[model samples]
Target: MSILVYINSNGNKIAKNSFEAVTYAKKLGDVTVVTNGKADNTILADLGKYGASKVLVDRSFDGTDEQQITRMVATAAEKVGAETVVFSDDLVGKAVAPRLSVKMNAGLISSATGVPQGDGTVPVNVFSGKAFAFVKANTSKKIISLLPNSIPVEEVGGSASIEEFNGNAGDTRVRVKGINRPEGDIPLPEAELVVSAGRGLKGPENWGMIEDLAKALGAATACSRPVADADWRPHHEHVGQTGVAIRPNLYIAIGISGAIQHLAGVNGSKTIVVINTDKEAPFFKAADYGVVGDAFEVVPKLVEAVKKFKASN
Candidate 1:
């Protein structure tokens, strides 16, 4: 089967989820990656380590407009005679996959957790990670938007041939005014470990402990919706049904009461550790480990413990 993977790049580097998507596609058949923007050939060639055989770089479009990106992907799929097209289940994927499916008349599996089974069915998260449902593509062409961190990325160790794709970039309807990136060592969506807090921290002044803990563990920082709504933290830090959904390897939620809406976003994490003073906090029921304690006392000690472990090692 011929496979085409659409990857997102930051002009200099490719997103981690995109590598996972390429790795996933490699399992099915020959993989070709399509990306836009100005990136070095070395950066594009690095995808070979993750199983991509070829890469199509389109410098004509910078990926500022989703419509143009959709067109670029469709054209590349046709050029490669791709039977399967894969994308990372991110903002870019969510916006373009549906449009590409419509244009190509392909069956789309959004938020796919795994590759197709022997029965040709794909498993996907449903009801906000509460359950799993299998879907099959009845069409000749198939499109899948894979969830980030669902598949572990492995380096197969090979180099891919790079070529320029001269495709048409449709007129842009959206214009960029400025770019305000979130502050963090790792972007929350791509982070393997995350340290998050809620209103129980009391105020923005108390966030120093959260940052200290996150720094110690090399984890990204997040907050509950209420904390972001109250301006105690930036909205980008909010994670919930109505905010950013994450599936980090480990999620340490401190002081969060874990409302159903909040759980909707983070329940996909591989491991959850909840720390709250209320023993009956809803988050504890979903957490793999629960610590019934006050954040003021627990967080400082936890930070010290992590620091000591690092020092000893």
Candidate 2:
């Protein structure tokens, strides 16, 4: 079987999600990587290390208009005679996979956690990570969007040759301007660990300890829905059913009562740690590790412990 995997780059570097997707696709069969925009020599070498047999760079993508880009990728998959195509279940994958499915008349599965089974079925999370649903496509060709961090990134012995493909970009309706990123802030979707707080900290003035602990752990800082709604934190930092959904390796909740909506967003986390003064807080029910204590007393010691560990190591 031949598989075509889409690799999304962050400037000249490959995103972790795309790497995970590539690593997952390598297990299936022969893998071909298709990248949009410009890819540096360093990134191409990294793809070869991850087992990409051939890398097709599409410079005509122009990084705008998902519709036009989807057409380009679909055409490339056809040219390569790919039986299956894979993508990282991120913003770009979410936008392009369904379109490709329509264009190729193939089966499309999003947020898939595993590779195809013997019956061509894939497992995906249902009901906000509450359960698993098996999905299958009746079509001969299939498209899959793998969830980030669901599969470990393993290196296989292989090398890839780079090839350039100038695709039909079509009429560009959007214009590129500039990107604005805040300094020292990690994108929650890509963070391996996240430390989040709620109103239990009292007010926004008391968020220093949370930030300090997150900084010490090299984790992203998140907030509950109420915290963002009340303007204590930005909306981007909010995690819940109504906010951002995250699937980090470790999730630490400070002073936040576990509402079902909040749990829905982070239930995909590999491990959950909840710290709250209220012993009756609902969050403890879902926590892998629960500590009944005040944030003021607990966070400082946790930060100190992290600092001490780092210093010793």
Candidate 3:
């Protein structure tokens, strides 16, 4: 009765959220990882740092159809005698877990935010992370999807032992469509600190200062939903109820008036700092710290302060 984690093959390295899943899995059983690409041992080495003891390498781990991959993992799960299969609550994980649970006739718990006890009960939050509840599995096999950013990763040890899966990858129906990414070195959804703007930025051409602040702090850049709707920023950069929900350690909202929908998405951040000229803006109530001043005037000075702070440190 061990916990088995399915690590995603994102680019050459592993997915950041998968690391959190590994951390959660290690607590329940022997940590095992599955990789689908021809990544070298170095890629697996990082996983080892976070306590993954073994990595199962599969040539067919590609973005094949759900039917084939579910079978492949299910076969491996049965062979390994994994009583419980854990997956990160990601796009791919959300898609595959239910199917895998149904195919294996296992109990399914999606969006689990905490570790499960030896018992069948799993804890989850509801009402937009406002409340907690325990979910119990009905079957012998329990499959759980863990939410991202719920658990922090700690490097206990183990680079990972690489093994091969005896499955063919050609049977999947889904094919790779296309991949798109941000312009900078960091992906915002995964960043610890995020420097974001809203429609208050006026135009996209004025984004240089925003980028400068983000670059200085090694943070990701983001914008409000309206900015994305206005085409001032990419839809990918939009953060709100209809957009991405971020849980960064620090989030700076420059010129954003802070709507209820926007607050719903960003309320998960550890610390929120809002900068706007309107003193009575709704965002101020939700902000951990706020500055009631124009962004154009305040942003440059704030950027300088951050630079000085970093330099002094």
Candidate 4:
């Protein structure tokens, strides 16, 4: 089977989830990656390390126009005669996958957690990570949006042939405006380690501890919806059902009472550590490790420990 994998890059670097998608697609068939915007040849070729056989660079589009992207992907898939199309279950994937599915008359499997089984059924995350379900696509063409961090990435050691794709990007309706991004060391969705907090820290003045811990651990910083709503943190940092969803390797919650809406976004984390004074906080049930203590006392010690460990190592 021939597979077409759609990836997005931040001008200079490719997103980690895209690499995971490429790796996942490789397991099913020969992988061809399509990306837009300007990037270095070396950066585009790096997809091969994750099993991409070829990289198609389309410079016609610079920004994410979902409609245009759908058209480009459909055109590329048709050109390559791809039977399966793979995407990372990110914002771009969520927007474009359905459009491409309808355009190609293909079956879509969103939130695929694993590769296809022997019986052609795919495992998927259902009910907000509370359960798993298997889905099958009876159509000749299939589209899959893989959940981030569900698949491990490996380097197979080869460079993919880079080629220019002249696919139609459709009409441009969206105008380009200046982008205002939150200041941070790492993007939250792509971070492997994330340190988040809620109102339990008292006020925004106490946020230093959270930043200190995140910096020491080389982690991204996040906040609960209430924190963001109260203007203690940027809306971009909010992680919850009404905010950005993440599936980091390790998630550290400080002073945040775990609400169900908040858990919906972070429940997919591989390891969760909750620190709250109240032992009865709902987040503890979801945490792999729970510490009942005051953030004022516990956070400093944790920061010191992380710093000392880093120094020793």
- Regions more than 4 Å wrong, model 4: none
Q: What TM-score against the true fold does each predicted structure earn?
A: 0.98, 0.95, 0.91, 0.98
- The order of the candidates by TM-score, greatest first, is 1, 4, 2, 3
lDDT of 2: 0.87
**lDDT against true structure, model 1:** 0.94
Give lDDT tens digits, candidate 1, residues 1-313.
8999998888898889999999999999999999999989998999999999999989887755789988899999999999999999999999999999999999999999999999999999999999999999999999999999999998999999999987576778888888888886799899999999998999999999999999999999999999999999999989989999999999999999999999999999999999999999999999999999999999999999999999999
- By summed lDDT, which 10 consecutive residues of candidate 1 come out lowest? 166-175
Error of 3 at 71 (Å): 2.1
lDDT of each: 0.94, 0.87, 0.81, 0.93
lDDT accuracy of residue 13 in candidate 2: 67
What would the per-residue lDDT of candidate 2 be over residues 1-313, giving only the tens digit for each residue? 7899987776686777887888888888888988777778567867877878898877866474678778777877887899999998887888889988998999988889998789878999889999999999889999999988798888886678888886554667778788665345688888999999999999999999999999999999999999999999888899999988899999999999999999999999999999999999999999999999989999999999999999999
Winner of 1 and 3 under TM-score: 1
Give one digit per residue, the lDDT tens place, for model 3 in 1-313. 4667887766576767888988888888877776576677678767878877777777755663666667777876866788888888777787889999988899899878888766757887555554678999888888889877778988886567778886444565556778666676776667789999987889999999998899888899999988998999888888887888777889999989989888877887889999988898899998999998888888888789989999999
Q: Candidate 2: lDDT of 68? A: 78
